[model samples]
Target: MQPVRPAERRHETVARLLREEILRGTYRPGERLPIERELSRHFDVSRSVIRQALLILDQQGLVRVRSGVGGGPFVAQDTMPAALAAFENTLAVDPSSVAEFAWAKCILEPAINAVAAETISDEQIAALETNVEASRAALERGESAVDHLIDFHSILVNSTRNRFLAIIVELMSRSMDRLTGTAGIRHLDGAHVLEEHEAIMDALRRRDADEVRALSRDHLTGIWREELGTD
Candidate 1:
């Protein structure tokens, strides 16, 4: 891999630190961040680098940029949804990234299922069963099952009770869905997805961690295979 330049590295580091701090609630909504010069001095970088970092944060929807005598960067009021929207608006999430996102689902969902298999409550399993039933009905009615498919996976993620993992999965799933929808990739095989979801639910109900892991991986692989045209 190519090396990162000093200025760019500093800018990215500062931006990541600031973004994490804001996300961790160090800076609340409507609160203005440190001024450009102060931040530059704080990070021992040039003002331009600080400006670049702030611009990155602005693009991520963690902050909003303002101008004039009383304007600067302020923390976003609703960071999560705003960040997702900003990500969608940016040209960054293209076809390639969508494919990669699907692969990430292949990686994460298995572990999520592993955890959910061990810790999920009965109510959670029943809820997933409900989702599976809904998906089956949708498929029977000749409707797209992707929505409930996403919802079923979402419920599985949340069943792990890990906020960080759930949030990451949610963001990636949301972005992938938006990209696929935009690109008109709506020819998902509803019967297959429904069957896999039902099988996954059965695995979860049986508390079979190994089967759940394998099933989740296979399910997500099916999704990305369709996207990557490797099926």
Candidate 2:
């Protein structure tokens, strides 16, 4: 294994210390974290390392950074952090693997919809309706609205409230999106995608688990394979 850089080691150590303190209720939410100089001295690391640690904590949704006087990192209200580091690492694979990621999506997304059918809330469905409307507008403007399309699926997956499931789905979708963009599949059939999303939304609203699963899978296949007929 490659040797870890000094800064990397310091940041990890400091982040772990801070993370434990926050989780153990040593630093309650809304309470300001110790200043950087104090943290650096206490941890025997440089201010840069302390800053890096705080940045990691912020990204993990464990702390909020404040600016100006009486401002520093504070424990955030929502402390749960998904394994998104894994998702980003997964998204970094070779471009030739787009077909593989797309295949995985066919299996995964439909399952997410099935779960959403059982666990999704009215508020979540309403958010999906807004996503549908955004997709419609994008198609009307002759755009793929893949971002909106991605958001729609993301919402569906997150509605399951299963972080691991959401992370897996996000990893696949993000990978496929990156690969398709690199392969010039960005201008995919926006109108067709919109229709499929709307249909999926309808099924979800009716809480038809089977239809949601089938339609979600079909949508991925229709767009990923049938639309351009290319990998």
lDDT of each: 0.78, 0.76
Model 1 segments beyond 4 Å from truth?
Answer: 1-26, 30-57, 65-73, 81-101, 182-185
lDDT of 2: 0.76
lDDT of 2 by residue, 16-134 (tens): 87888888899898888888888877777788988998999888878888899889888987543334444445556554555666777788879888999989999999999999898
Q: Can you list the residue pairs that collide in candidate 1?
A: none
lDDT of 1: 0.78
At residue 114, candidate 2 shows an lDDT of 93
* Candidate No. with top lDDT: 1
**Which tens-of-lDDT digit does each residue in 1-231 have in candidate 1?**
122256668778888889878878888999999888878777778888888888888777788888998998899886688757865666264545655567766897698789999989999988998888888888788777767777787799899989888887777767766776621135667777778888888888899999999998887787678766765
The RMSD (Cα, Å) of candidate 2 is 6.4
